[model samples]
Target: MPEIKKYLSIVALGENRDKLARDLVGAIARRGCEVNECRITPLGDHFSAAMLLAGNWSAMGKMESALPGLAEHLGLAIQFQHARPAEPQTDFRPYAAEVVAPQQPRLLGELLDFFTEQETNVVEVSSQAYDSGLTGAAMCTLHMALQVPVNHHPQTLRDAFMDVCDDLHADGLLDPIKT
Candidate 1:
């Protein structure tokens, strides 16, 4: 198999996060590339992300072509490149995920603590879950950098996260892991 690691950076702004993710994934999938993970960074100005994908070189080309239109639609600059491989391989498959949790209407000390303890860096987080008419909640997006080891069944990560949530009393709404 020809293994390769591709790094794609996408910038999308606005309060509508669902739309941004949907557009990016849709555009990329249409090109035959599967997004392995997206780490969104909220830096007070805009949304930035480093996405990892696995697919053939042809899919990479298709994604590159469609990125510009998506960027324009979201009003953000898009920069992408492939990771330097020490050896030739088909594509890179990583174990990662984007988890969203709903915090209490009160302060987010507990929620923030979970991110810190888990070592899952926060790319971007919002304290406005209720702004869209949902119940009072704060949401965070974590980008897990370390991929799962190749030879063992995955454990430790999710349980650790759940332990944190249990201590902090935060409710996790979405926890779909890509392992």
Candidate 2:
């Protein structure tokens, strides 16, 4: 199977930003799809959220149809598409990540910032929600044919995640994990 990635961006504006985001993620996940890069920004009276989704043909196709209804429910605009150019000819070293955020919108900002700082481009990003808090999982897969100096590894990704976690924690977005 060739590597195939897709991104789904949803612009949601409402009174409850966190609830809307969580519910949106839940809807995607319920379809058995994951959100890779999740982004939420405040645009005055409304909040704009863009989530990157990664999955195979069937999953992506399913999300495409279901997301619009989900967006309408949240009273927001929904945009989604599978990444073009398809997957490369190499097997990217993929590291799956799981992050929990209680602060909601801030989480999206934090996720974007970490990836930019880590020198890692988001190859395939997708997300899903679990419970009241948001549970997002992103796959960090590197393009080996690139000329970049940074060799791909798990630490590179872990470092990025930790940085975001720390920043989110400092800002009271992340809670101490329950044992």
Candidate 3:
């Protein structure tokens, strides 16, 4: 018999972030589905989550129906779709970094392009904008995980990243991911 593989990509938002995540994960696991990837973010007054699950078609069908009702009962918005298999991991060095700067348009776009040119793969990214209550200035903060291939020089990559941050007038720091 041929192997059967299925996946689910889900995104949800709700006011009760913690409760929603706990309940949703518990519900899926109870039904025998594997939660492969999950990222939850608290958006001040709201919460958002993205999750990937692996299960059989029948299991997915159950979730497809059950999730909507569950979310509605909790006053949340939910979206889901069947997902494709993930790409294989490559041999690379992982790094984590954070950037902070004055809020402005095009900052993220420029940073993304710089990473592309440097042959870096971004594993995860989270960004937020907020008012600096003391200074009354707008600020943007970005946190990211990146994979840099072994072929590249670590110092070189760090220098290039810092250069970009300098141009944006942002402050940044990069460090190796500890195993």
Instruction: State the C-alpha lDDT per candidate.
Output: 0.55, 0.55, 0.86
* Candidate scoring better on lDDT of 2 and 3: 3
Residue 67, model 3: Cα distance from true site in angstroms: 2.9
User: How displaced is residue 145 in candidate 2, in Å?
Assistant: 24
Clashing pairs in 1: 1-90, 2-89, 2-90, 2-91, 3-89, 3-90, 3-91, 4-91, 41-123
Better of 1 and 2 by TM-score: 2
State the lDDT at 76 in candidate 1: 64
True-structure lDDT of candidate 2: 0.55
Candidate 2 displacement at residue 32 in angstroms? 1.8
Off by over 4 Å in 2: 1-18, 84-179
lDDT string, candidate 1, 90-162, tens digits: 2322444444455344335654565466544443444433332465445543434333334423356567656
Model 2, 1-179: lDDT tens per residue?
77665555545555545576677778888876787766775656577676677676677788878867776787777765555434643433334344544435556556655656655445444444345423453222211111112365655555555676676653212111232
Error of 1 at 111 (Å): 22
TM per candidate: 0.41, 0.42, 0.82
Better of 1 and 3 by TM-score: 3
Candidate 1, superposed: residue stretches over 4 Å from native: 1-18, 84-179
Best by lDDT: 3
Model 2: how far residue 122 lies from native, Å: 16
lDDT of 3 by residue, 82-115 (tens): 8976776677888987999999898889888988
Give the total clashing residue pairs for model 3.
0
